[model samples]
Target: MADLWDGALIDAAIWHARTGDVARQFRYRALYAALPVDALEAAHLPLRPDRPGLWRLRRQDYGARDGSSLTDFIRSQLAPVGLSHCQITLVTMPCGLLHGFNPVSFWLARDDAGLRAVLAEVSNTFGESHLYLCRHPDKRVIAPGDRLSGEKLFHVSPFLPREGYYVFRFDPGPGRFGAWVDWFGKDGDLRLQTSMIGKARALTASALRRAALRHAFQPLRVTGLIHWQAVKLLLRGVRYRKKPPQLEIRRSEATAERSDV
Candidate 1:
């Protein structure tokens, strides 16, 4: 497997008419890296932790725990679903000097047959995170546009209530990748929709340099945009819900069996 996969994506979020007729949409060009967990120990990639560079990934940023190897954590997470000896490609933004603020990251696990499962690590601005394990009902391989759902356990956005669920659709490929997630109310109404589409590029120093030059301070920009949008929502009279206590680690929930919106 390649040490890393570098790419760029257009990250967008749309808050549907959940509170009044207010709908807000924002788009930003961002840089992303698909790194294999096993490759973290190898010195084959240009980006490294605590290094001066355009982009870098830190070990403490992800995985089931802060100090554990990501590969081991992923394998443990997949073991419950009977997925063993599978390759995992983590699709996420890198943290450099400016640091990263990823709302979510995808871990695509595949075996000999095809894509087996996906582990989504979701986070909020409040420094809390949750993991949602999404798979087919019969352990079937997931394909592009396949629908997956999970109950809302951890609080993410203050504007969003803690009672709704999330529906996810993914389009993953070697040349490109796309993901869509929609938050639905208890009544099954779409409250918010967010999606990301990106074209893959060969992971190399040159590619990383070009992406950094094009989207300098991409991580900070992502955080800034998030807050700016929240401000806009607050101005629109959207009531903010109090954030609950943080849950550092939680068990993954099975995909919900329900109609797709």
Candidate 2:
């Protein structure tokens, strides 16, 4: 695994493309933080946990979202599936200037054997979230080329129905990180494609300040962009799908069913 503890910045770009009824595509540069589950307790960094700082990573923003130990929450989910004793790194957006919102965050679990699993914590504007666990059925290392898939149980966009599956791919490296999530319909037709690809560098105090200067009020900007896109889609005459009832079980798991080079 890469030495992620040295820094916490992922200078990344996020993109989304829709190929369904309406054709829409967009990309934006975004900054993210990479924090190992163990490093959440470290207080030496400019970014601190559960407190106000220029950059903040609140434990209540993830996992159970109840101000619980995120590490323990990750372990509880993995232990039941025989995936304990693994290292976890959370790649997410931290609260910038005491205001934050993450549409999605990733919990990357790895063991001495190799990449074991990934928990994609996805949230929507409805103030709800869901967890999708992706791994291999035979407990094999999840290579970059692997395509792990799971059904779409939670409603994300009002323009799309709650029927489909997501194909997830990850490229984890020491100096860079990349991930792709493509949505497909019941007929196996591609609907949407989204990705976050970026370079990793040491996040010193200076670096944090630079990022702040570049992307100030990032959380609000992100939220506004989301609604702005929705309005665009609405103006484009895309039908709006109502949000469904909350899922009793807000978590789902998928096995790596195939690999494509």
Candidate 3:
């Protein structure tokens, strides 16, 4: 993977059946990049903290600290899983000046053996964040179409209950990236399904500019869409659940069960 990748587009959708069978979907283009921490600090990218341009990426918006390197932060998070040496690549939507909203972002950790582990950062509209550590049970490299399950510990949406499990599937590749997350009820029945699929391209100034021109207010649009969907769900008579206390970190049941991996 290259240090930077632009022109990546995402087509995402969600389906829910808790309240009168409500569903909402949207499609938007976004830029994806894999910036090594050292390179990100030294390189001259167009990302700014508070400014309006084609596309801007702020370092403080991710990881744990305001000015800390993301690579180091993610490395520490993966240490408990026996993953020491690996390359971290972030797959997320860039923060635009109008507004920045990332429902979820993936941090792919690759080592000599292949994909060692994945750090999934989930954010809610209330500005709370949670992390989910996913890895294979056999300590082998994770391959495409592999499924990993984790318990739900954080509150994200009002329409969905807090108690349940999430089944995650990924199909990461050199040319395309795809992921699917299914929320299962306590009875082991499917309740909600969400997915993201996109293609990859080299990250360059021109590519960023083009993407920005095409989707200038993507961040704002995303925020609006989220709230709009929530309203739709409410109007449909879905029971609203209050947000629960936030959990800083959560590990998959499989990872927590086995200490060797």
Over 1-261, each residue of candidate 3 has an lDDT whose tens digit, in order, gives 422222233333333334124554545444454444444455544443324465666666777737566667887887777775777667777776577788888877777666767788888898877787778766687777677888888788988878777777776666677777777766676777777766556556676677778766777888887788788778877779988777655534423221111
Candidate 2 per-residue lDDT over residues 1-261, each given as its tens digit: 235545568988999999979899988888998887776666656666787666678888888989988878999989988887888888898877746888899888888766788999999988899999999988788999889988889888899888878899987677878889999888888899999999888777798878877766788788889999999999999999888898798899867553331
What are the clashing pairs of model 3?
Answer: 47-57
Candidate 2, residue 247: Cα displacement in angstroms equals 1.2
Looking at model 1, report the run of 10 residues with the lowest lDDT sum. 1-10
> Which pairs clash inside model 1?
none
- Candidate 1's clash total is 0
What candidate 2 gets wrong by more than 4 Å, as runs, is 258-261
**Candidate that scores best on TM-score:** 2
**TM-score to true structure, per model:** 0.87, 0.93, 0.83
* Maximum-lDDT candidate: 2
Q: Give the TM-score of candidate 1.
A: 0.87
Error of 2 at 72 (Å): 1.0
After superposition, the stretches of candidate 1 with alpha carbons farther than 4 Å from their true spots are 1-21, 49-52, 247-249, 254-256
User: In model 2, what lDDT does residue 192 have?
Assistant: 96
